[model samples]
Target: MFIDRAVIEVRSGKGGDGAIAFRREKYVDKGGPSGGNGGRGASIYFRANSCINTLFNFRHGITIIGKDGEKGGTKLKYGKYAEDVYVDVPVGTVIYEEKDHKFIGDLNEDGKIVKVVKGGRGGKGNACFKSSTNRVPRIAENGEPGETKRIILELKLLADVGLVGFPSVGKSTLLSVVSAARPEIADYPFTTLIPNLGVVSSKGGESFVMADLPGLIKGAHLGKGLGLTFLRHIERCRLIVHVIDMGFSGRDPYQDYLDINNELKQYGFGLSDRKQILVASKMDEEGAEERLSEFKSKVNEEIIPISALTDDGIDLLIYKCVELLKTLPFFPLYDSEEEILDHKVYTLEDEEPEFYIKRPESHLFVITGDKIEKYYKMTNISTDEGMMKLITHLRKIGVDDELARMGAKDGDLVQLCDFEFEYFE
Candidate 1:
């Protein structure tokens, strides 16, 4: 299976917590806080691999998690940071944040590494809190949490020219004759389920890649056929080769050409504006010559007449394609970073209050703030020193003053996050 798109969840490791300890020795007279700090968390990264051509490797819902950092030890010994994790993807893979549709990075070159998530920072140890006035401080902080994200990965095939036309238009046959790619060929429509890429070298020894895209019908832009599924592969092509079957069908070659162009125009993304070469296939058929003449009269541009079975006019077509490739500029798959920044747009949302104080019931006060909630989650309230640190932080941030202004009395019940305590004046 040639998979091109996938969705996966990734998470970075959290930092280790700080340790609190006191030095004990036989001859040492003065021993203060000796706790060591925790180590930092691991980070997640994505690397490009040219050997892999499809996204099928990530078919399953894989959750990538980084290794956690080692914990701190006694004697003020800091913990070791964890190693970062790297996931390899195929070249030309583009990643986007699933929720907000934000563009993360594009992996266009092999061995390119992009940091997807950053690890959390480690907390400070009790030794860091020691002061002259305090003398024997016993406070230690917890490490911060790592980042988590869900992203979408899309792969676009890298090719120089793309062959697009209705079904059974000698696209696969032409690819087989030009390069080593042997796509499935049949008389029925939609024979080529997936895009087939081939390398063609001109007589001058210049080589370029060509892609045999799936067939496009009248409503292909609206996703009526395989065109909608494989149209993305055409975005990277520098030129388009429209192969028209001039024999064996009741459909007019001229109308068929117009419908395909209409679909390309509707698909947008500069596909219709791309340079195109018209090739009328099966010229050896009985009515092919007459149809080719009619098509030529209708369209003023040069249309190459070819019979893939007999290998006639294939050389001239390849030569023309190569000549065009020399002058055409390479099209980048993504927009410039400056272009993205210049078109800035803001998302409006209801502004949240800095802090909220509410009384769920009589004498039961609830305090909540984004910052305070995060602090509460990281605080270790099992020890008396931990509780004191939390109280001091709240007071420093004016939370206590805000509570007093809200008619909070002495010994009143106060709740923050999941922890509850008695309020004091």
Candidate 2:
């Protein structure tokens, strides 16, 4: 079960609400607000694990949620913060945060980790609203909400050189002889379903990775045989080793070479900027030399002929590849992803907190405002003492003054978000 891509939901924990309480000691001269603030929420993180190669585990679990923060308590005791959740993925994974189509972190290097979702901030307690004018304040804030997002994770195999040619052209055969990788090989087309990686080393201890990707057909780019699957795997390659079958047995060998290169060019990096080597396979066939000679004149590119079956010209191919790799610049194969540096921050002048709640919605006072919501989260509403602390806290915050300015009379019906009460001091 070699999974290459996966989509999952990630959520950070919400912050805990603040506690609203007053100092009610027997000998205290005057008891003031003494509520504690709520705890911070847990954040969601993505870690890169070199041991993992596939996204098979993610398939089973689509949603990953973090633990919520503990609520604040009385006696000015702050709530406990929750631990963050870490989701481990294999290296070379690229993630795209779907909301804004923004590219996230590229987990190319081993042990690279990234924080995906941010946790909500904890609310303030009533004690924070204390002031000289008002001794008793009655307002506690609720905890902030954590961030949630859905993203796509794709795996790009790291390979130094990629083998490109038509199906059943002996790309896998050449790989078997040169490296320890034993890919499924047969005489039929599309025999190798998955891309196979092999390590080729020289006598001087020079080594490079090779990928025997699925074959490319004439319409591969347009959703033909192996189609986009083959093209995507080779995107990271520093070089394209074009394997041409001069002794096609029936099909036009030259035409086959043209079609494959056309597909590569059409798919664009246009990878034409990268290094390429032309190699004629199945050289043991009769008249292969004749066709090879004619093919060179038509194509006029550097061609290395080889018989992968008997290991003929295999060494030369390796030598040529090692030589080419030496001169080429080292480019990361996980080039599909670009590092993202900034996050989207929304800001609007005079933007009011506006949200609607239906009536008969469980005594819900539809309140509006960022400051108010944050205050509520920071408030601890568990105890009556805490509630008093909340009210006194709110009063000190000039909520009472604001309400008076809004034209409130004695015994007037007052409305606040999530809670409603009769107005009278």
Candidate 3:
């Protein structure tokens, strides 16, 4: 039930259509245009909630849609704007666009909100186009279309310290003894399939969140034994508590320590460089002291020996974590400037072309672009005035000139989206 990743579809609401009406009062000699403008569409937003800990609510591949605006009323009344939609996700959730895998935003704190997609703008009424040169305009625009997108949500547990080691190494046992989290513990490997979180309060009144991640094997970086599924969870951890099983008869404690460090180095994300506190578990077991001595001799760093069952050295471990946390700063998930820039949104205003021209056939020319398509969708082409407006926009944007340069002749076909028309120069 602890789902951390999900793919969902989201859509924003469309604007309401404009109303075309005229005054027919008995006392009025000449009635003017009294059309009303359409209402605005709803926008979609994602909010972070501290009470939620997983992405399970969004695992069912649901499609979320925002509310549409109300239609415009008669007597020059403007339509009502739609209410925005908000989605609640767990803290530390990262969103990305599914099509190109572009990073949208990171919700790492509680109550943080991000607007993922914007709704379409409402169209104008015939009264909006009334001018002295062309009084009593009869054209009314249609409503704009909504935006649809498929996004991916990934959850990374936000913890001050992370418990990492091989399976059955006392990581979960230590967590249960120090905090209220009761993780499934067993004698076999991979007993803790999912990550577990607990809050540990030191004797000095200092508290910090700790996470017990799943076990890791030799080839973990190469997709062996849980693989990258759980390794990503370690990226946000500020401190790593490496627990080594000094009592395991078949395994060498020093070798285990070296192997786990190698996996962290290979996984990248600056995990190997992260601050660590070495813990030797099962100190009460027979022959554990001898192995601990050997591990201490091989490594110059200090290691704390603790027995979870007997509560020996647990206070020292907790105090050491709190002491070190005061000096250590939070590590960013993205370290390099290039990585940060890649996640940002940038606009290429003057560099990119407005539209592209493609000729699939000698008699047909296809025009495609984001701006052109948007205008085509919002224009009300049923009336002559609307059609003339679109034609004027196309000419102003150099579409007509470009077609003429391409040897387009009269009666030739021009395509924009699904609509096709004959060119007349």
Candidate 4:
């Protein structure tokens, strides 16, 4: 079973909580805060492995979670940092965020790696807050939360040449003859469901990779038959080898060539403009020569006529492909500058507001934002000093001023996260 696409959920580890212990040595007097800071959480990364060819390992709706960091220890002993996790995927795998389909990364080369999510920073201990004016601070911060996301993985086979045509066009047979690849072949259409790759070597000691892509039908760009699923695999091909069935009586050889080219044009990605080599397959058939003559008259490009069963013209086809590949350049997956820019993920660090206030009712007010929520999660609010410190920080950040400007009166309910308190002043 060849699987090329999969969706999985990944989560980065959470940072360890800070300790709030104090020294109790007999010789020491008034031992200040001795708590240690927490360690950083584990990160998640995706790496490309040339050995793997499919995403079948991740097809079972797998959920990958990074290891959490160890908690801080007493006596000023810091917690241990969690190890990062790396996942191996096939080369030419493209990842996208599931929610918005935003492009994440493309692993087109072997050993290529991309960090999908970074671990959270560790929390500070009570000793971090101790100063000349303040001693024996009892506050300690909690661990930072981890990040979770659903991502989609798509695999596009990388090859120098891609063989494309309608079903039963002797594409698989040609690949098996020219190279070691033995793709499934049958008399019916859509027999080859998955793409097969082979390394073809010419007699001149030149070699190149060839892919036998799945069959394409009319309206394939619109997802009619085996659709865009296999068409995307063609994006990585440097040269397209269009195989036409000269022997088949069900469809006209000339019209077959036209329909397939139309599908490639409609699919975009500069596929229509890419370099191509036309081949007439099944030349040993009774009316194959007649069909090839007609196809050549209708089309201006040179077509190599080959019978895969007899190995006739196969050597010429291989030599032509090897010679042509030496001159053709590799096409980038994204064609335009705008398309490349669209894949980049931008962060609004300074442009976004620090916090926002929402009034759900006449007597209720809610404060919510990423920055404020992060501070709320880290603050140790069990002690009076910790609670006072949080309140002072909130006031310093202009939360109090914003509420006052919004006509918030004393005794009105003010909520931050799950905690609700009465507005004062």
Candidate 5:
């Protein structure tokens, strides 16, 4: 259940609506609007938790939503704000904007938190819009909508050195001897299915992390053996430890080294650029001296031959790894603010008001926009009072002028999206 990658949709909360009320005290006569404004919506954030190692927590989830803000109250009392939502992930977890594939955050340090989505701002009440000329205004704004996004989370294990070789090359055994990591060891190929990490400390008390990646076969890049699954886990490593079976009893050590290198090259993810160390494991077996000499002649570099069972050459390898760690820079990767998104609210008032006219059988009209929809949905125009209210609203929004410009007459028929009306003075 050590899942490393997941895709989930996230939505921030929407702002609350503004309240519309008037002062009704007995002592005060004709009081103005006393309504309160709405509260702000909840934000969405992502926090890094060191205790976690996988993205399994995000499983079984397709979307996450934050709470909406509370509505405004009377007597100038503002509504309560919604609580923010938090998504926790393990260290080394990278957040990417799935739509654009942009990097957002790198959870390198423990307890680091980053805001992924900001909540919508609350709308103002009619009371705030009241003026000396318009003291009894009955206008109020609705709540703003929240932001929605789709993001991808990926995890890469952070380590100092990565051990890579062909199957059954004693990589697990080397790690078991050098560090405290226990990996499944056997004679068969592809014994290590997953990457195993270990912490190796030197005599100077300096320590570094090492990972035992799965064995790579000749066609690893083409889905052979472990395929390219374990190759991705080693991209974050600083050094590559080439553990060849210097016992050279079964295969040529030089050819094995070249074969693994070629796989990394084919993968082409900056793995070959990393610092590599030459170490031949299983040297205790007979006829190892001739193989070691031949391998040295071919490689022409310093090679450490180790016998993991006898605990020989373990300390020297640890020391060499530590020394290499000191010389290299403390390489750190970072993410920028461009990974997140900005939230915006859209309202009908801001849209272009357009109405259509057609003569399918005869002349007909169709109107669309913020004001017309409000008159259709909120007005009960079957009654004379409702009809009067609709006319007053339409006139206030300049609907009559628009109809005249479109060549409408007293006998013409008018329509607002789905409603039809006979024109009159």
Candidate 6:
């Protein structure tokens, strides 16, 4: 199965919680806080693998979670950091963020890697808070949560030349004769369902990759027939070999040429602008010469005549393709600068408040925000000193003032995530 696209869920590992402990060894007159910091979480990355040709393995939505870091220990024993996860995908695969449809990275080259999600940072231990004023601080932080995202992977075939035309126009036949590839071919239309790749070498030792792509119908650009399913494969082709059936299919060769080129123009992505070589295929058939002569009169460009079955004019076609490829420039599947600018950017000035107060019911207040939620998760409120330290930090951030502004009275109920507390002025 030639699976070109897939959607998968990926998650980074969570950091380990900081330990809150004090020295209790013998002969120790004064024992201060000795809690160690938590370990960092594992990150998720995507690497390119040249060996893989398809994304068939990732058909179902798979969640790739990184290993969680070990918890901190007493006596300043830091937790162990988890290893990062690296996923291997086919070369020329493009990754996109599913939610926003933003371009994440393109694995155009082998061994190319991009960080998909960053792991959460480890929390600080109580030892980090100890100072001249507070030597026996009891506060310890919990581990931070990792990032989760749904990403889409799309594979684009890398080929030097792409053969495109209506179905059964001798594309598969041409590929089979010119190279070692054995694509399924039959007399019926749409026989070549999947894109087939082959390597053709000239007599002068010049070689180039050629792809026998799926046929393009009139409404192919609008997703009719093979449609956009295989259109992406053509984007990488430096040269397009427009294979036309000369009076064989009883279809007008000129009209077929116009329809196919229109589809390319509609699809965009610089495909219509690429240099094309016109080929009047199946030249052995009767009336093929007359049709070719007429097609030459209507079309201003040069058209090569070839018969894949008899091996007539095949060698010259290969030589012509190799020569043309040398002068053609490489076409990129995506614009790097445009994709980079499309990604979300953040500035310090755009930062929101640490917490926001919401009154869902009378005598009830809710506080929520990124910074506040992180602090709330890290707070070890079981200890009185820890709870006081958290309260002091909340006050410093104007959470108390925000609550008062929202008509929060003394002794009222306040909620932070799942935790609830009695408000006090």
lDDT of 6: 0.88
Better of 2 and 4 by TM-score: 4
Residues 82-123, model 6: lDDT tens digits: 899999999988999999997888888899999999887777
Q: How far out, in Å, is residue 410 in model 4?
A: 3.1
lDDT for model 2 comes to 0.79
lDDT of 5 by residue, 1-425 (tens): 56778999999987777677788999998888876777788889888888888888787657889887877777777878889998788977888889999666777678888777787666556577588887865655545667787888888878889898988889998888878999899988888888888888788988899888899888888878888788777777888888888774489988998898888877766676668888988889887778888888888778888899887788888888888877765334422222334444478885766433444434555667654564354444544544665778777777777777767778778777566788765
lDDT, candidate 2, at 141? 70
Decreasing TM-score order of the candidates: 6, 3, 4, 1, 2, 5
lDDT by residue for model 3 over 1-425, one digit each (tens)?
66778999999988877767777789998888878888888889999999987898889989999877666666788778788899999989999999999778889878999998787677777778789987878777777878899999998878889999998998899999999999988889999888889999999999999999999989898989998888888999999999999886479999999999999999888999999999999999999999999888899998999999899999999999999999988776674433565344557764557788899999899999887888888888878888998899999999999999999999999999888899989
Q: Write the per-residue lDDT of candidate 2 for residues 253-301, one digit (tens) a residue.
A: 8899889878987776446567888889999988899989988888878
* Cα-based lDDT for every prediction: 0.85, 0.79, 0.88, 0.89, 0.77, 0.88
In candidate 2, stretches whose alpha carbon ends up further than 4 angstroms from where it belongs are: 97-102, 249-254, 326-425
Model 6 stretches with alpha carbons more than 4 Å out: 24-29, 186-188, 204-207, 248-252, 326-330, 335-344, 347-364, 369-371, 396-398, 409-412
For model 4, state the Cα shift of residue 138 in Å: 3.8
Q: 1-425 in candidate 1: lDDT tens per residue?
A: 77789999999988887878788877999888888988999999999999888888777968899977766678999988999999999989999999998888888889998888988777777888888887677777787778899999999888889999988888888998888898998889889888988999888899999999998899988889875777778888899999999987778999999999999888877788889999999898889999998998899999999998899998999999999988887666543333534244665654454467888866789989876786875666776888898988888878788888888888889999889989898
| Candidate 6: 10-residue stretch with minimal lDDT | 335-344
Q: Write the per-residue lDDT of candidate 4 for residues 238-296, one digit (tens) a residue.
A: 99999999995579998999999999999988899999999999999998998889888
> Which regions in candidate 5 have their CA more than 4 angstroms from the true location?
6-9, 24-30, 54-56, 62-64, 97-102, 130-137, 149-152, 218-223, 249-251, 266-269, 285-301, 327-425
Q: Number of clashing residue pairs in every model? A: 0, 28, 0, 0, 0, 0
Off by over 4 Å in 4: 21-30, 132-136, 179-189, 198-209, 247-259, 285-300, 325-331, 339-351, 358-362, 401-409
Provide the clash count, candidate 3. Answer: 0
Cα miss at 25, model 2 (Å)? 3.7
